[model samples]
Target chain A: MQKTLKSLSNKDPQNIILIGNPNTGKTTLFNSLTGLNQKVGNFPGVTVDKKTGNFNYKETKINVVDLPGTYSLSPNSEDERIAKSYLEETNQNDIIVVVADATNLKRNLLLFTQIVDLGKQVILVLNMMDLLQKNTQEIDFKKLSKKLNCPIIPINARLDKGVEKLKEAVFSYQQKENIFLDSDSSSSSIDETMKRVGKINTIVDDCLTKDGEDKSYLFTKKIDNIVTHKIYGYLIFLGILFFIFQAIFSWASYPMDLIDSGFGFLCDFVSNILPKGILNDLIVNGILAGLGGIVIFVPQIAILFAFITILEDTGYMSRVSFLMDRILRQFGLNGKSIIPIISSTACAIPAIMGARTISNYKERLITIMVAPLISCSARIPVYTILIALIVSEEETYGIFNLQGLLVMGLYLLGFVAAILSAWVMKLIIKSKQKSTFTLEMPIYRTPRWKNVGFEILSKVKIFLFDAGKIIIAISIVLWVLSSYAPGNKFEDISKKYTSETSQQQYSEQEISTLIASERLEHSYAGIIGKIIEPTIKPLGFDWKIGISLVTSFAAREVFVGTMATLYSVGDADNTMSIREKMMAAKNHETGEKLYTTATTLSLLIFYVFAMQCMATLAVVYRETNSIKWPIIQVVYMGALAYFSSLLVYSIFS
Target chain B: MGKSLNMTLDRLKENESGIIKQINDEDLAIQLLSMGFVIGEKIKVERIAPLKDPILITSGSSYISIRNADAKNIEIIV
Candidate 1:
């Protein structure tokens, strides 16, 4: 950490702070100033978003810390506290930049004035200058600069206009003598809310002039009337949600198919190109397949986050929270919890991190706890096969396919279970965390596509680095466990099969498969599978199914590959599939059916509720800053999956 | 004025206008006040969510959602 920080900065780059009120185009300005040259991380202990970047200004290096956008200095949420504390403990040479919205000067200046009263050398950046002409509002820059006793620069951050001038002001501001306001910071308090509002209003009235009143928000109000309507609002919201879900599932499938085939082709190509050995087999069969498991889901993750950022950029996200507030509150979740819950459908790692926006800790915790209950894209693989076994492909009711309806039912069941679990956990989690659910509904506008794109790119990168790291590591460990055996029992099986090859009527291919299956049955993984066979027998699973269950802890989707491998050793054929193989298998003692309706349904229920993915547990630990929540999450979900499967299998049998 | 005269935020009718007199709840005081629920600020109930508990209020140029528990403490005027 120390080495990277030193290498990035040019020997202690000057600390230039970027602060602002929410919706002031601060993020756009930060992007304009730093571009893609930024390092994203968490502030020391708190998990609020912290972005720092290094840029060169006139041969001098400037290090800028982008504090989370806040309303005022008096802190409420953890995000607010980070910005407030940073300003309070500011270094002497640090230049504080306050980004303000030019059109909405009255409210934006509230924070600017508080910082000015702190007697710091501050620069006021009047952003969104492009909207001034549209709103017919004008700021008297000369008069406003004199009143505030600070350097003020007006620029439209989106278009990157006046950026060089702003940079010049930032660099040259240090050359000028420091100016301080007369009042000390002591008088600012919650008791003076009225006083502060009145003062800022007066300042706004004096230095700002406009021909029309509230004209900018008039269009916004018109849209809000319909979008925020009692009945139509919810209908539109659900409609949009359904649209997004369809896009995430259907559109992502194209890229997912390409990725899957690409990996399969690569593995086969490498196996043919390289000399056959254990290393070649490990790379071709184990490592490449494990990596393909995660790389395929990238398309779904990219689409889900792209939609999330687009909603945020267009200002529709806060309105969602506004609509969901009442219903979710009954489950002890905030309106903001909707984003995470929807995001969980794609993957839980990003969903848990997205909960950082929720100011209330308890609500965020509950959201994280119940998030994995939502059926993710990984579960779709498991659900599709199981549902296929239980239901027929040709069964359709006019327009809707019966099998597709069952898939939809599984999704709805996951969501209903998430909310219900949240309701139950709400009554249990005891925290002194204060509850506040106030959301600022920004006016609707065409999304800032550039900003949205950048945000999506960053979220995907974070998902890869945080969850992807754990996934790859666990997959490697699983590869080792499944590939090797403890003793020469594998050699004995190969020897026995080879000796019989010369004396028997079996072909070389048939002999090799027998040897493969025999060796796998005596491997360490097989012994472990046998150990858990009795425990899972009540759920109608055998030792082979137990192996898939154990290996899938690395990722839920690995269950498919595990099943394919286990089935292939005995009957590896291009014509017959893993499902067909499972269908052909029968118990030695009773010639009874396996993969029956009861067992398949039980397995589906198990995948729906079990916390099978290690990546999610790692993220939950990182987000909660404790292992206790993730541990409790695993236990309760495991217990739920177990008992529910037991009940469902019994009734079905 | 009969219904709106001494109503708290939770009791305010949909599309009603009021000036925030006080936010009596301690837990909600800082957040609401900072988000511009200050005394004498004119707030209009733009809409109420379904089930009539969480209501949207527009203060200045900002629209915010407040639950019944927090809204019950926000004393308002017609």
Candidate 2:
């Protein structure tokens, strides 16, 4: 027992926390230490990112947690509160590793001094020493260490220099007497801060030497001149956005096609090999089809995150925010909302999470509320098919496809709808909190490719796991609802179809197809679809389309699969696919053609304005920590979709 | 401390440096203070937005962008 207690006391993994001001290369340092061995979770009851990783240094295992970057311990934002709360939770085993940008030492030291004043065990890391060297600046590390009574290490985190020395410091650290800085004034916290700055300035003067002026700022300033120029700013920002959309669609198309067809082949193979039973049907239709819905979106999700992380890492997002603040503020959005709103085009789940950075509460709520209206990638399949049905392939002007242009116009309409909703919400929600525009503009630097790649992989993992779980569950439930019905309805359909197969001398494939379609039309899901048909009839939708709408509530892109199944049975000729079946659909009563330009346009508008995503609603609830907001979101978006679709259908039909 | 020495940060031109003397907005002052915008330190205007409302300033290598209204609350002396 005594030996076990001794081992437990001495061999427990040390909790080493990395804290620093933003843009100080702290994350880079954490990455180098832990590599891919990291656990990313949210802090308890909060959505703030908590990343912890394990690594073995010598004989000791250390749990290194990368705290969110903050300027001071006095928190002004949720991200900052997370950092402060975790730091205040300081156990005796906790050791703080504070990272400071060497090129900006005096300012970075302010946070370090505050941590030291709290008597925390800290090892100061001076990062960006390579940039310092380029500018011919030198620091007296030994003298500074003696004065601060802590080990000071200079390392270029990007290049992995001086990492070994940091490890040695962490292993050999011993508790020393806390030599507190002088309390020069009894006035206020402001005075205390002033005194700390005075101390940092003196230390900077004595231990630091600069031989030449830094020229990096000039380049940033020069770029800002054009990028933020009033007329040119908007144009350049639009150009960047155009290029981003182009890249997402073109570059990701190949992998997306591969994933789609791969899932199809797997489903077919499994169906053929497995015996005709409930399990076989469940595996092919329920599990594999549901999983395929998520896997196909992977390439698009990956490319979207890569673009965002690159923009963030290179310090260009802040510039875009700065340039957009004036326009966005008028529409009741914070400048930071642009990132989330634009990203929502790729997906709304992460877009809502991205709203955490907006400091103002009201602005954040507004951003989250309108974000999903931006028409995400799930709507792409719906739009592509609908647009093609309306506009023929020959209707292209030289290099531009008319159908592609229509899709672009739909994206723009989504943006317009989102902005308009934000405006209305601004008028409705009453709050006294004033919006503040105090953003930090980090110096421009080349993005770390490793970090960007890691970011994409991690975000993709979050989507694949979190949203993937909900989507798979919803689809499985949907499959069961569509497959079975009360009172032996499916059994009756199969028996009726079997007798017809024998009497008509139908082929084996034709018999199964007829049975499948007859069963689907009689299932509980089909009945629910018929029930909602009256509500959506004015929107120019039939019961078959109604079924697609019901199934796609789990995810918008399911409309395609739902339609494919509904149409496969409708097409007696057996040559037409989903798209062709949709094109050939005709009204039973009027004998007029369905899928007219007006009806297709109405469907597009409805999708653009509707909150038809279950994952987004759940995420919104999780993020806001309130059921009220998400309910309100659904009701409002649904009303918007209904009214807009009605108006379009009325005008065009 | 002279009355004539009181000049809000918004009045400071590009590349002009000042020492903060006081701040009119209490909340803004506390936030700016903790972020190295203390009364004694020097701050220099680095850049201005194209519309000229939000401007970037540097206080000891830490750059911050604040709107003109917020900047106007910070009283300084050139």
lDDT of 1 at A118: 66
Candidate 1, A42-94: lDDT as tens digits:
77765556888878898977788899888887776656777898888775556
**Which structure among the candidates has the greatest lDDT?**
2
lDDT of 2 by residue, A1-653 (tens): 12343345465667889999988988889999889999788778776678889788896887889998998877777788888888887765568999998887877888898898776889999999888887677888898888778889999899999987888888888765464576655767766776777888788778875545665577787887787787898898888777766666567768977987787788778878988777876676666666775677788778877887888899888888888787788889988898898778778877888787788999999999999999787887788668779887557757666665677788899999899999999999888887888888888899999898889889888777865776666666667777777798877777776685474888877787667666766778778877998999999987777877777787787776565545544443334545677887776447688888888899889888888888889889988889999999999999999999999999998
TM-score computed on alpha carbons, candidate 1: 0.88
Looking at model 1, residue A611 earns an lDDT score of 92
DockQ of each: 0.57, 0.63
Q: Model 2: residues >4 Å from true position, as ranges? A: A1-11, A182-186, A381-398, A401-404, A494-513, A557-596, A622-625, B1-4, B13-17
Question: Model 2: iRMSD?
Answer: 1.8
How much lDDT does candidate 2 score?
Answer: 0.80
**Model 1 spans > 4 angstroms off:** A1-11, A175-188, A353-364, A377-407, A429-435, A501-505, A554-598, A613-615, A618-628, B1-7, B25-30
